[model samples]
Target: MKTIKIIFVITFALAGLTLSCESISNPDPINAIDSTQTATIQGTAYANMDETNDTTFSTKENYERAPQGTNVKVVLNSRDFASNIEPGVDYKSLTYETTVNSSGDYSIEVPALGDPIDAEIYFDSFKTSQTQVDSTEEQRNYSPQQFPYTVRISAGLSTFNDAIYNSN
Candidate 1:
């Protein structure tokens, strides 16, 4: 009779342990989906031109001209890069491109999975001129200058005012 009681107690304890483990292992489905939502990034770009021709454009006052028609590229990735280092080439990333408007403003909406997303933003500018020899022909020169930087963005609106110095 004592053996029967011992077996019953052991079976009950095992059932309870199994039930508790199953509940803890499962996660809420709604919360899991909400974590991987989207985010929007918007900002204005400026060209820090050396109006005085002195080759100094390190201050905020020098960023007076708007960088119209500049290409603004945003790359979303899982890791953040150093400020001085260029991003997107070495890692798996998603790229989004937009052109700076006439007013120098740009807006891009990108998928930002995880609580906070990592992004690399940069600008590209080109100078196009019509050649005097051929009225219908034009010359395009791509600027080698660009300012690439990284940022940590959330699931809402994030703003960044970027200024790239004019290397002309």
Candidate 2:
């Protein structure tokens, strides 16, 4: 009789343990997709305006007169240069007219949805014969301005993981 009671108690305990180990049904998924994300990427394009004898202008004047290129291209892709750019999506130019402070630095505004798109600003100098005087050398040069930087979107799992891994 004692053996029978012992066996019953042992079986009851095992059943309880097994029931407790079973995971409860959750209405929500363990990893819900996060829709809301916000991030910004900003950097300065460092380039002084073309200063030539034909355009006898101060640094500030030269910067101000410098034709700000309208075609500052922003190329964004989901993969890391693995595939070609996505189609049907239009990329807006991030070029704006702003004065370079006494320290030759220009701020270009690049508005974005959540995070600024990965991009580089190429400042293509527009030369004109009217602006060109007797200086032939000045007319032949094209000052291309380029700035490379990364704009991170808001904190995602991948970003956090990267940060933690990098810190370690």
Candidate 3:
């Protein structure tokens, strides 16, 4: 009976020790903010002219028509509150805007707030000069495109490459 009691006590002690070690390793409370934490969203914005509506294109044409120096905006809206507050309250939201370089590459850094930050990316319209089949240059306008899905970001870099916008 004594031996059994000793074994039970040892098992209980081991369990307690494991729980304590786990708590020690993770001392941060839920949703604890680390001021230095940030996340980067980067991608290339492509402006393709799909006149045929077949959704097929040549690689050379796509590279030549890529949008350059266009604005890209990343927004993170606050989650809905338990009360009557609406989703995406202004006070808790964040917006980061940047312009793509000549290579159609853009990067935006946002604070890593919640456990998983949800953001939406928007591409602004731009005007460029395009050569017509007759060898004449004319100005062409491209419409803005918004990401259809919400992007989830963590503490590191999140890349959303190949953001192609079809300008028909």
Candidate 4:
């Protein structure tokens, strides 16, 4: 049995590209069709690490950029042609990793879904804070967001715009 769900996509790919179409019954056109050109994906991540002025939510001003060296995980699976896929590559393979710049932002790219008929994306926004001031004691209090990060890939879709973060 397939349970229906509605997802409001607040992000769009560059150049106003709509790789898939939407319908009243199904919010995602990618799942309905088998072959297409590409897919759109994006989102924001928030974590409480170094909040200046002890603010509750993370903000760019308060938090230092994501230390440019940090890398985020992105996985994709175009479940179509067996030959196209490597000997053992599928979704959750961690085949792709991208770095987050000082702005705590990342652009995720995966094989387009339409090549076969379907593509799924999983982005991991998990990172630990580093100690500042060479502290012997803990740098700061920690409280992580339980829910997965919100996505902002499609121009037509948006949710939780961007994450708030504070610098240590």
Best by lDDT: 3
Model 4 lDDT per residue over 38-120, tens place: 34444454444543343444354445544454555544333443334345544233245666566666665544432323323
Order the candidates by TM-score, highest first: 3, 1, 4, 2
- Our tally of clashes for model 2 stands at 0
Best by TM-score: 3
Q: What are the per-residue Cα lDDT tens digits for candidate 2 across 12-126?
A: 9999999999999754222322335423233333223232442444433333333333223333443322224445544344333334334333443333334333533334344
TM-score of every candidate relative to the true structure: 0.51, 0.29, 0.58, 0.40
- Residue 93 displacement (Å), model 1: 1.9
In model 2, pairs of residues that clash are none
Off by over 4 Å in 2: 1-65, 80-118, 128-137, 145-168
Give lDDT per model, in order: 0.60, 0.37, 0.64, 0.41
Per-model RMSD to reference: 12.1, 17.1, 15.4, 20.9
| lDDT score, candidate 3 | 0.64
Q: What tens digits encode model 3's per-residue C-alpha lDDT throughout 11-58?
A: 999999998887445432334335477788887766644333333465
With a 3 Å backbone cut-off (N, CA, C), the pairs that clash in candidate 1 are none
Per-residue error for 119 in candidate 1, Å, reads: 0.2
